[model samples]
Target: MQLPIDFQPGWAPADIEDASAHRFLFLQGALVVLRDGDGARLPDAAYRDLPIGVLHSVGVLDGRACHMAELSDAELPEGLEAVPLRQLFNRLPEALLAVAGRAQQLLDFARSHRFCGACGHANELFDEGRARRCPACGQVAYPRLAPAMMALIKRDGPNGRELLLAHGARFPGVIYSALAGFVEPSESVEDCLHREVFEEVGLRVKNLRYFGSQCWPFPHSLMIAFVADWASGEIVADPAEILDAAWFHIDALPPLPHQITIARRLINATIAEVAPDHPALSVYGAG
Candidate 1:
């Protein structure tokens, strides 16, 4: 699969000509608003001439069309369909991806919180351009991060070739992924993992091992990944969180999301551990 240009971590260097001083326009949801003459759609161009800063990235938006179609090697010009930048993080490297992801979360949160909840008055951007404060009640607001965890359960069967997998109702076709859930207030990541497993599927997971983490901003989710071994119990999916659960062999697996997602990467990593030529080589499928 072709990687997105904006996916590079630290892609936009810090050094720029008076970026903070200028009134940067938000290029939201990959709208790709085109310029009048040249027909270029960039969010915040330099002097409204040369394209420089982008309001959002491709991944954040619905890139299903682009994903299915072959992406051309060219500058992201104007007149593109609208998609959110959140989808681009998995396409980008870690640090730079975080830059766009966090920035988007902050920008989106600030804009959404502009209308005061208490007084029903519009809020204003803070001095640092990082937060929003209500003019009436003087309420200070910051972007919220929802802490969530995903657990990959494994078990040593008599044949030692089976792995547990899950297919959420929301998941398309036969796509499967690890069990995931949001963290409760004051609950530790470890605690959330165990709870999520039981709630989503009627199973007990032991030997929980942290795999990695990624910023899943499909509306602000910091997904923490872990690997756990199945102790016992049958497959039972939560009516709310999951649709179906099952066990599959390592070599043969169902479809999975393609990207830097901890679920797909860890699955592939484990598959590689047993068999090098894993049929499902990529995290976001073969797209």
Candidate 2:
């Protein structure tokens, strides 16, 4: 996938104490950001006038300090508007979008872990690492990430190769995408994929190949993606979680998730593998 932003894994502050015009991503909540031109813009001097505290430095992007803040009951500055992170996908470059997601996740980690769960004492931010330390109990809290699995199942049908897709209970009407679920405490990623496939659609899948991964920071989730082949069982949508389930031909599909998602990546990759010449692959800029 072509990523737009150049992001590094670890945090490296350009200047830890610099108080210049630092770039800011003011998140209205966890999922939305203060929209700027084509991406999130830094809060202007007027915004800096607000009692915004010490900017929690997340990382250096292209040799600049990128920070994020959460605002509550504060009026936004003129010419700036709050936009949902999902919507930002269409407006911002992929790399910037990914960076925004990273910033938001770290900001959330800072906000949610202000107090230690194990000990009632407040937590302190470690200067060198992205961790919150508790003074009383010596418990260290790191950024929380929930691991989820996504499976794009394929099977040969009467006519040709087909891909399995499902509509989640959260989706409206006929919209469908890859089958996914969160990993439980004791289960492995493979185990979770199998169990989720069986439970959601009453189907078994095999040849679980790791396709790719994406950071879905809808409240901090690491989406582990896989492509699998249908092994057994019939289509039986679980009423509680799945609205419907079916195997679709490569040429025909419902309105899918956005292009930037790992679900779309798995779908497009599978279609390219099974039917490279299929016209639907054109949507993903494939032959």
Candidate 3:
């Protein structure tokens, strides 16, 4: 599924020549500053006087030049509040939320790559690109993205098509989502998917169909989602990874992840395709 945000990513110049027509995103750690108003909105040109450190361009957002900057422990001015990125998930438009995630990732990349690993020398930002170069060892560090896979397994049952949902040990409350795992070295996404499904639930799956991908910016993960058919074996939840695993009928699913997650999208799309007449389609199948 395509995100609603319209962003054109490009390299940022060393210095912004003009700040009047630009939109600034000020971040303190994982917290982004939003103007106190009717709704959550980034600080506009009026607040440009705030302290800025190591500014990075986050491309254009809705025809406006967007930039990101890290802030020190400076006190926020009146009429502005620093809000955590997680709290702004559904509060902001999907497009703005996505751009905010991108800004956060870029800020994180810049903060963690200040020094080189190979050599103990301090690194310098490239003049024309988004990378840090170690003059001593010629080591270049760019933004890091860990590719992970999300699989929504399904099977034919007496009731109808059943979805294999599992409650992850790390999930909040009783929320259940599709099985997911990070890709290892020299392993393709499909291979990782198969391994993750079996390792987590001890179930073999087949008929892998690619669904979509999302940039999950919780410390930086590119989630590739898929729909797979259960091939063999019964549910065997790994105590270390999964709290519970079970097959639920399409119309009788339990509480799922939030709409911002790709897992929710994958599940909704599969249900819409396999069970078009499902009563929940009108509410949850738009993904």
**Candidate 1 local lDDT, 206-258, one digit each (tens):** 99888888777666888898888888888787877676678887656767655
What tens-digit string does per-residue lDDT give for candidate 2 at 1-287?
A: 23235554455543434545344455465333446656664444455554454456666566555665565545656666667667666776666667777777787787789899996799987757678899899999899889999999998878887889888998745678999999999999999999999999999888999998888888788899999999999999999999878898877787787787888878988888867787887775441
Residue 235 in model 3: lDDT:
95
Q: Could you tell me the lDDT of residue 117 within candidate 2?
A: 95
Candidate 3, residues 35-67: lDDT per residue as tens digits?
Answer: 545567776666767777766777776677777
Q: Residue 224: error of model 1 in Å?
A: 0.4
Error of 3 at 209 (Å): 0.8
Residue 58 lDDT, candidate 2, scale 0-100: 61
Better of 1 and 2 by lDDT: 2
Assess candidate 3 and give its TM-score to the true structure. 0.91
Candidate 1 TM-score over all chains jointly: 0.68
Tell me the lDDT of candidate 1. 0.59
TM-score of each: 0.68, 0.87, 0.91
Cα deviation of 239, candidate 2, in Å: 1.4
Off by over 4 Å in 3: 1-5, 14-27, 35-38
